[model samples]
Target: MTAPLSRYERVARKVQADGRVPALSVALHRADREPWAFTVGESGNAAHPLGPETRFRIGSVTKTFTAVLVMQARDEGLIDLDKPVSAYLDVPAHGDATLRRLLSHTAGYQREPYGDVWDTLITPDAAKLVAELDRAERVLPNARRFHYSNLGLAVLGQLVAKVRGGTWEQVLDEYVLTPLGLRATTVTTPRQAAIGYVVDAYSDAARPEPPIELAGVAPAAQLWSTASDMAKWAAFLASPERIDPDGRVLAAATLDEMRWPLTTTDETLWGAGFGLGLILVPEGRRVVHVGHDGAMPGFLAGVYGRRGGEGNPGALGCAVLGSSGGAGQINELVHELLRLAVELDPAEIRPWRIAPPAPTAYRSVLGRWWSEGSEFVFAWHDGRLEARLADAPADRPPAVFAPLPDRPDVLRTVSGRETGELLRLTRDDSGEVVRMHWATYRFRRFQDGFDGGPASAGPEPVPAG
Candidate 1:
């Protein structure tokens, strides 16, 4: 047993003592380093020991992979995120539902396609699945709410098939699994797969449950993989350079966009918000790409990665799979492992540090400036000037400014790409700044003998194309 195992063993013993689960599997990886795998208890039958190679159903976690493929199609110009799903697939859209809305779970579709849960061991094919669309059309009225819908994801699968000119399973096999060298990963049934099991709520005992087959909603939850392969997938998400095998799976920019928050939901409390498919977590001082969690009839899993290239000194990632139905506990365990990984080696996952503030001698430039029809305040903080619009929205924060290069009369918006100039500070015999020129607009200090306040608020001058 390894020293880390001694620590992990204590955790496993505590889990067993709670009697919530009977088995667990975990895998950890860092850039340019081999992954660490651990298992406790019998995975399914109490006779077979779970190992790094053990496969498990990755429920909703499959959505992250599917989202990645959609991003790939978008990057290749084969599909547009803004386009309507009906544009690609012949699906009927009762309202103005677009692919972006569907991807972000804002389509307002019913939570589930069928009113009741279907047997996972027996699922319908794509064509048979589409026949149920009539019922799916009666989704909620307000499409902006974050309502997770399995039917909405099924529609996304249909779109992928239509755009890629193949079935969703075929697209996953050809574009994602094959390119990433995930030979053991697939949307279809495997020859040697781990049987799912659910813990008895009353007895606190475990029993094997039939595999939750998802032929119709495969895009939403049919993926299956071992901890080892999932480690590679997590590493790819954390360190983009390490696992983008042929550069065809997903572009770096598109991947970055996928990590960007499209919306925030109440289901998870982690970070800025949910992106295309992955969950964002505030780990320590920096945000990290925490993998999605999966829960099937008898299986549960979790995966996570760093936010940049593997070359980044401390990039780290991990994957965990188990043959238990209660995934919430396993998810918490993965987070604990992540915390330990960073704490054990701070240098490997250190938070980004901002550079120290520089000295600025222009302290007089900071003050409240008022013009007719407009009143704004400027203050200096951390060696930078900040501007606050008195009448702006409550959620919008103040804007920061930096000094213009080789120009004392100009200040640039710290968050903007362009610079603004403070041309001249007009003065009278009394030596008071009665008027000033900013950019091309003129501003009067609000004293009696000055021109009108600021110029008319028209569109800023734009360069000709």
Candidate 2:
């Protein structure tokens, strides 16, 4: 191909040509390569082209930053996620609603604080917002369901500000943005930021959306960032160890805790769930992407990064920003970007090499075998006995088993199907591996009767008595 359109370029072109968004920019980051980015359409008007640095309101994605601060406070013993917000700040009812409940949107708090501010396009002062908390009715029992509470996150912002003895914005800069080198991300729209617009649903015309300043609710939906800056944030979410390295911002383990799903709204929707602060997404159990999405009056933004499992440990991420809201394309576009990246540019598989001499007991069973007419491979990889279906799809990784210390012929599945199940190897009279039992199912080697199939070229099966 002479000049193939890159994945980013193709997505950006599709986003722009859709004509729903006035401006769009997207970026993709993989651990092994530099980030790829593309932009199309105008930032403010028909002439100015949207670029990688063009900032857009990242609405509720601000909540993820706010949640990180809450988690940091928890790690420092400043706040307990299991304790009540009233234990930390001035709130009357819902004292039974724990910080964990609030963070995960299970606190049963009203979605918004008591106010006509949304209609007025104005947010109330902290004092007024707190004074109205008594009016926030609990629609559901505490920790019962996934009811998103903007007020709950605002209360968290207040907790951060109160604990740090600084404004929430200051604490955010000191604890997250500055530490992460997200220089362009800001609480207020920067001069280079694109102006938000709402495209008419019925016509091609669009109207400018008024700038809304979220005073007390800033933590819930008030931040502006570019795709470039957000790509860094996504990378950090995917693998904080590589990004932070020194734990200056947050530890890798703490980040992992954030990805653990706290609750889900429905049983049928396994793809969506709420974590401590991040989002837990299982893309058909093949891959799980963790991140957040944001939407304001006229802007939409999304940032998702792969939380790899099943032998896919590489870090990959995508960030999408659009100046037009209600188009619903940014979310889809960001997801496609991640899926394509994983499909086309997966991490290089570690080359297989001979392992050091295994213990005398393990040497006998570590090799190719057959189970249920399917070829299975058992080899020592990275110091563990890994078993894989030889004809397994490329996307599927092997089942890893850790040998039992007391018994050499026994192993336990640690990180795949039949996890925690014991694998007991059986030996013949001559001490050669005859077959293995896993989850009460027999697995025999190719030479071991082939599970009593047609006669093998190797040895004849000893008939059962």
For this target, which candidate reaches the highest TM-score against the unseen true structure?
A: 2
TM-score of 1: 0.71
Q: How far out, in Å, is residue 447 in model 2?
A: 20
Candidate 1 structure quality by residue, lDDT tens digits, 349-463: 4566675543444443356565445666555666676655557554444666655687544556544212343334465675455555555555543322235533454458899
State every prediction's TM-score relative to the real structure: 0.71, 0.79
lDDT by residue for model 2 over 1-465, one digit each (tens)? 112237557766887678478889888776777777778888984444577878889988899999999989989999888888888887767767898988899989988888666788888666667777888789899877899888988888888889888888999999999988899899986778787998998998889999998988998989999887887788888888877899888898798789878887576766688898777778875677888999998899989887664444455778999988887888888888787776666666878777677666677788887766677877776777888888877677788888789887888897666778999999889788878988777787663453466435556679999
What is the alpha-carbon lDDT for the whole of candidate 1?
A: 0.66
Please report the TM-score between candidate 2 and the true structure. 0.79
lDDT of each: 0.66, 0.81
RMSD of 1: 9.9
